[model samples]
Target: MFGPEGPSLRELAVQALSSVERGYDLLAPKFDRTPFRTPDSVLESVAKALAPLGPFADGLDLCCGTGAGAQVLTGLCRHSVTGVDFSAGMLDVARHRVRPTGGPEVAWVRGDARALPLRAAFDLVVSFGAFGHFLPRELPGLFTEVHSVLRPGGRFAFPVLAPPRPTRTGYWMLLGFDTVMRVRNALWRPPFVMYYRAFRLGTVLDELERAGFGVGLHALPEFGRRDDGSPRARLVVARRTQPAAGNVNS
Candidate 1:
């Protein structure tokens, strides 16, 4: 659901018809006002979870639309933070909106997340609400790029909600959404690739392990337990494990 300042149904329709990059560019101004942006509660939960792992010297936010996760980096990393996105418009909004109020300096870089420019350059990396744009096949390179950017022992973290059960209404909702996206991509010239069902946690953990991260999950207690008593959401913290030299002295 969107607020008064958010995009109207007509505006959302127009965005859905456009390519992912172009749609994000069009939506950048109202992104924070929409449901698409990561909520502050989730970000706060993540920041608290990551605090014990700090203090990092530098960090990067992969596919950082409006830099919500990147803002978390300012508190975790003591030195600098960089927010990168393929959409110039999104980066522009991030530059002005989430500029570091904490001690760490911030920079906005316009580039693709699949082929990040940095190498072993950051102490930490985080992303939020941007995974639906990438197909499952692209995750290998996406994880690799995140691994490449982080200093060994550095973390590549993000929140992943539990997949809905087969009988659940939410399951059908995602299944229907993915099916519609596939049909749209089949008929449309430039595809709109946001699909809720594409990113699976189990499959994702496998991909991340193959990409050289020692993966672990931390339960976000604030979201509470499901009916089965399993935590409904977790922060996937994948640490790059190369050698002690890549380790954080702090």
Candidate 2:
């Protein structure tokens, strides 16, 4: 649900009808006011989980929209922090709004996650709340791109919540949202590709391994657990295993 300052129903409808990039462009100015932006609690939890593993030199925030996750990177990394997103409008909003407080020099790059422009660069990489835009079939290329940009022993980290049970209201909400998105994409050109259920952890872990990453999952205690005692949320840290061209330490 959106707030008083958030996009109206008509604005949301127009955005849904447009391409993902264009829709985000239209929505960028008010995105933080909407429920679509990653929450501060999640960002703080990730920053805490990453703290012991870091003191990193350079970091990247993949699919960085309004740069919330990039702000998290500034606290964790020491040298430079870069936020990359395909939406120029979103990057413009990010550039103007999120200010880093001296931990690192922050920069914004407009680019696709499937084909990143850099190579063997970052010591840590983080993404927040943007994976649903990529379909299941695109995972391999996307993961590979992340691996390519990270230096050897560098990490690719993101938070993933456990799927809601069928009996829960959240389950039906996600299901209905995905169904509507499917129908909308079927009838639209330059299809908007947001789907709630497309990114599965099992499949994603497999893809990360195939992309030369040694993956690990760290439970985030802040969100608590399910009835089965499984963690409610986790941070997936995928480390690049192959040796880099230079003997650079991460």
Q: Compute the lDDT of residue 49 as modeled in candidate 1.
A: 94
Please, what are the lDDT tens digits per residue for candidate 1 over residues 41-156? 99999999999988899989889888888888888888899999989888889888875564889998888988887767898898888899899999987887787788868998
Off by over 4 Å in 1: 243-250
C-alpha displacement of 168 in model 2, angstroms? 0.3
Q: Per-residue lDDT of 148-188 in model 2, one digit per residue for the tens? A: 88887899999999999999999999999999999988887
lDDT of 2 at 41: 98
Query: Residue 150 of model 1: what lDDT?
Result: 81
What Cα-based lDDT does every candidate model obtain?
A: 0.87, 0.92
Candidate 2 global CA lDDT score: 0.92
Q: What is the lDDT of residue 34 in candidate 1?
A: 87
